[model samples]
Target: MINIWAIGMVIALIVTTIIVSIMGKRATANTADFYLAGRKVGFFTNASAICGDYFSAASFLGVAAAVYASGLDGAWFAAGFGAAFVPVVLFMASPIRRFGEYTIPDFLFARYGQSHRARIIGVVMVQLISIFYLAPQMVGAGTTWNVLVGQGLFGLSPYATGVWVVVLIMTLYVALGGMKGTTWNQLIQFWVLFTAMILVVIMGIVNGVGYSDSVAKNSEKPLLNPGKVTVAKLMEGEPGKRLYDVNQKNMTPEAFAKVQAVVDKGDPTAEVNILVPQKNKLHPERAMMFNEPGHRYSALDQFSMVLALVLGTAGLPHVMNRYYTNPSGKSARFTTVWVLGFVALFYMMSQYVGAIARQIIPPEVAKDPELMKLTVDGLLLKADQVMPVMGKIFAGEFGLGYVAAGAFAAMFSTIGGLLMASAASWGHDIYENYVNPHAEEWKRVLVGKIAVVGMATLSLLVGLGIPAAGLDKAYPALIAMMVTWAFSVSASAFVPTLLASIWWKKTTEKGALAGMFSGGFGAIFFIVMNILKETKAVAPDSFFATLGTLTFPVLITVPLSFAVIFIVSITDKKLPANVEQIWMRIHGTAAERRERRMQQMVLQPEQK
Candidate 1:
């Protein structure tokens, strides 16, 4: 255990406390200020904050862990995550701001006219994504607390004490800081995160060369390509039966659930299991991580992550929400460019460290204390710990402490953004806009704080269920898996509307409403079907895998949404008639530049 590391973490917590206090003093009573930083943040500040908000524990720890386990396939996740932002920069940022809306609901209501069903469905989807997303952050904080504290400090279980303490601090921080406080915290945390990753990556590469040299001298086969192994489907515990075949058909949740009950009741005839291989060259225990083909290959190469990162960024709720913090639409765009540079620099370092960990950490350690022998278990050790473990290995005690500090910083920064987003949706959008339109600035701020705390509490409860789901075994993969849900929902719902609202002339209120419902409910159905298959009733992999793995399968949802809006708008016979002029502003950089020139023209006389 690294005692000094634990002490450093305590110091970081104290620093957070102080920063929250300062932010509270500076925060205004206005709900807008609380939710959107009073619409006056600078480009650099907003950029850093956006990076902080965007890079959750998933990015910090999850990506590196993926690369460590799955080799090149894991790199796609990091690339995809980063690339998702590009669409935001090119298409969504300025136009969404030009619409001048506070939340997604507000944007929809304003664009389509008041529609209760649309707002309700959109809100529910936001809540689902926020809550589900929050769990992993809590899990991450808990994992970091447990791993670092257990090694460095004296007492307390990691699961109980770590999660509680981390949540409490995060809740307080967001409650007091609001958007302004969160922005500052995220900015500072981004630097720390970037620094830690760079240091670790450099150290990792240096160590990698040394390890490779040693392995080259000792090994019979090349380190990159070991030995082959074969596999065939066979039922476990019952020798004669073959596993339930997924390749033959698509099974839904209801059928899967029935199959599960039958199996539980001791079916007279049943077959279950997929016979995957382990590497013949490695220890028998080491072979468990491979798929049926004796290698780890992710099926998610359909969209180049770089393209997703570039396009998906425009549509992400939390990231897009930060645009409201900027004083104007142009500042938001500038901030995005900054985020790209910062994130790119930081991820390079983390990826290097992941490569290093693959070489250094003994595959045996993954299974030293578990039923799952070393490899599968090794590949998935609480994804949150991948970076920290690398920190511990590379720099020893100091590295561990640095990693712990970085982890907590990353957790709080992300939680601050999520809590603020959740608060904005509930407090500013719903409570003030609908429930009490006449509420005072101070009252609105107070309500937002309350909502923030309440949401954090709810998320904490869900966080407890995460470990119970037996997901703790492979925490990183779970975190990455959960991210797909957020992506699916956001990409399905927000992307189409954002594009139509910005570009299309024929888009009408009815079209917007239809698009919203299609995107929102469609995502929900897919997710529910996937979750329902957990009982092993239907084919375990069919519906759920299809729902999750094809995040960008626009063929199913996008066209349906686009068509609904098109047909409905034409039937309604009411389009924004000045849509061409409006699109000139929405799609072109000319208007923004012209606005800049006009501002300069006015300021010239004042300066003289």
Candidate 2:
């Protein structure tokens, strides 16, 4: 069975690639060009590209899915994601660009002076976050592949094929065009995603009205509740179990007693249904009873997508980086405003489409072989697949093709930006500056290109390996968790380094190193501990009760780093003596520099 939908998507991707390649040639090939597109990006263009690169699989598919899954609480993820950028804009963005470094590590090292200790730890944070981030993209690739090609095309597993294909395409694009190609691709893809989303929203509203009217006339709750529900996954383990093989079966005796008590309290003679695996007496094979008809449907009409557009665009990294490509800091700020307007229009449309999917896709359809299994024994279905599933429903074969193509483009654009950013850190901050200071410009650029290819390949392998290793198919959740770690690391390390570089004169190399290390390492430690406790690797019997919450713990670490850095720097008392000169360069007026440059340009032209 040749799926016309899959074929259409392939065609769309090819068209997007050709168009971006043509425009990308406009960017000159040099270190500056490779890294920052020679700092000449205009406002509208960069802003659009930012929106494209920023949206990712999470924002496009994930947000819609989350809204559908959690009812009201899932909205918090989108809100947190978007609002995170406000602090970045007010505090980090302008100063970071002004500091004139390639990676977060580069900025830190530059501000703190060369310390091997800081470099090693910074690399660790980067690798951890990037690897974790890469896993989700890979998992998403598998997911989309499964939906589009798996069932329709061949007997091969959709999950395996999807991961490889998504990684393969992203690798090729990043390897070939570098940053210039990546930016152009992102800019175009952003528009496609936005357009698709708009169509979805419009159709959704129309669907909502029809569903709502039908329910109102019939005195029913059709649109109000999709009526699907399932049990949430609970961590399980036993004493003496290894970390990796802590079987989901094998709950402790105490846990069994607790469950029996609950069962007895309900009714002494009532027959209790438990799906337990044969070996584990306490733990069950399938714990929760599922109900497909009772899951809550979305109240899409009530959401404010307009507010989301504003904050969401601001928080994206790929979008923030685009401003650095602009000629001046002022141009970068202007580009952000442009992004706000463009993204707002597009996001509203996407939201509408997601809403439409909720209205049209029937509750019973989830159990159908071809449709999403939204309710699994009392547990809600994953929300991330809503947009893609909707595409299959409304537009039928054609819509599926369009949505998949757009999604692939979206992934490519964002992944390429990340690869390039990561590569720069390795090449410029680690290799060239620290390992080989005398390296030629051409060699440096070549090294970066090679590093980009290497990173992409490694990420591909890692992404594919994640599910194979039996970490569970919680790919989206894991990826989201890892990105938060990245954000936390950046928030802690970069926040201090940035402030010190631009504002504080007393910041010493020792203090910068301490802050970066402590903040980065401390967060990792806390997250790992929480995860272990959840899995019952650290404690078996009372897993949830044993695991301490992380939010307050994370807050404690940030200040600890800040304090360490400040104290260490003062004690060392050997700070950068020319700190004032460095500050002048970073914080100096652009008008003053431009005025001097204009005078020179005029004088040189007359002399020639």
Candidate 3:
């Protein structure tokens, strides 16, 4: 019963991570090296690291899981994720690198009048996005551990055990290795996930699963989901026309008997799990189809979802912070280009992997006893599990090991970046500047390491708390869904203000503040309301209930944030005195020219 392959994979990952951290710790002696890899990462290496940072458990497990659950609607997660970098390349990348700072907060605070208030706000926004983004990766850690270990260590649940274990691993690596270490680990991790995905796709094709044909066939039937409904809910309506009757027609005798037993117990609250037909919110007149729109999102939500994702990539503090690590502004732009190709290919293969899961999973689930535990009448009980389950079906426990390792890699890589960003925002941006401006270099680096631990601990608690809050049960693909919320917040709060700072010289601190609060908090309000409604905590007739119904609020928040910035900036007209100089720093290549000259001098042969 012991999964030696899975355990071996985890051990290998742990050992490699520890070794890298030790080496990186030796190399890291100052704040610059700790926070931004001493601003020495090359274009391609930075791109690979960015890919690893950007593709969280959300991409590795959730994208495929979303596709498996919601059909065509889920495919948009990949499209939106890939398209996000285009705006980054065209708009934000050059400015972010050219401005030349260790973190996004540093750049924003410096750009907007050098106010302490602005720095504090930037720190809050960084925490909001990083924590939101960090939680799902932790969820992935717990879920992967559940599958690998099948039991908990000590007296804790398997999920809690996973959260504690993974957090320790991440804290040790990021704290000790710093950006220099994580960058190298991220580069290696990206390839591991990419290879795992490619192998799944190629192996599926070789196993005689026709990609397009299978999807076409899948679309022919209404999508079915595993559902758990109480006896009272299932028994509603007329006899033979109730939810129970509809469910019974598709259920096996063994499954039906279990349901009947629950009903016969006379407990209205007793629940039974069965396959249920999915409804299309976009088109209520039509049945949900695998190839058509509207299983996870409504008509308006489709646009909002895409908007958040595309704009959000440019706004992510952790991802944007990486631009500062680039050797040059031009190299930063080139990094975005490489990121586009790398992520696009990974998502394409992920979609293929998801599509093939539908063909491969159901047929194999009934035969494998271990696999049966993950399914309900052969359909996956949780969509986030699609990749690993498919991996096992293809190549047994060894395949599970491969995919599970990839899942952890995805989580560890992203969490490491988030921790670095969080640390820089706190230790570098807040502690070094305001709390202890005159602190020694060693003290500054020590603070960063401490911040890493603090953030990791916070993330662990959030991970453990998610299940207790029932947030994990509120969505079909919670990993992908939760990450989108983070994207929505980043897009609405940061993107407009960031754009104005770079292009609009008239942007006052007040205007930036207005935009940040209006967009950032607005997104948060809607997200919290949505979660409330989803968990059935909000009254159906309440005003908040209406707001909560939206799956994505970016359509309202993004434009509103931009509009607030424009109006406030025009009225305030309190630009920084050195506005022209700041603008030049963003667009000019003086830094690049100086660096080029220095490099040329270094390259010149010494006269003997």
Number of the predicted model whose lDDT against the real structure is largest: 3
What's the lDDT for residue 539 in model 1? 74
Candidates ranked by lDDT: 3, 1, 2
lDDT of 1 by residue, 1-608 (tens): 43576567657755765576476647756777788878888999998888888788877877776655444445666677765666777777777776667777766665554556556666765677687568778777777776776532235456656678777887878787778788888888876776777768777666554433423332322123111111222223344322333311222343335334545666455443211222322233443331121122223324423333444455566777888778777887898788878877666655555555645654435333421222221333343467877676677778877877777777777777888888888887788868998988888888888888899889888887777765554223556555555666666666776687667767787777778679756765765554444323357467565564433333456566777777887888675555544554555576675776687799999999
TM-score of each: 0.77, 0.74, 0.95
Q: Write the per-residue lDDT of candidate 3 for residues 1-608, one digit (tens) a residue.
A: 55788789878987998898888997679888888888999999999999999999999999999989888888999899978899899989998888888777788788976877777888999999999899899899998888888789899998899899989999999999989999999988888888888878888988988769878978877888898898898899999868788768866776677778889999998888877789889889887889998997888888899888889988898899999899888999899999999988998888888887877887787688898888776778889988888878887889889888888889999999999999999899989998999999899999999999999999999999999989877899999999999999999889998998888888899999899989999999999998888887889778888889888889999999999999998998888887766777787788665665576588776632
Give the higher-TM-score candidate: 1 or 2: 1
Please report, in order, the local distance difference test score of every candidate based on alpha carbons: 0.63, 0.56, 0.88
Off by over 4 Å in 2: 18-28, 113-124, 151-156, 209-321, 342-359, 363-369, 372-380, 469-482, 533-548, 551-553, 591-608
Model 2 over residues 75-138: C-alpha lDDT tens digits?
4445555554555457555766776665666555655555566666666656655664566677
TM-score of candidate 2 against the unseen true structure: 0.74
Model 1 / residue 601 / CA error / Å:
22
lDDT of 2 at 226: 24
Candidate 1's C-alpha lDDT? 0.63
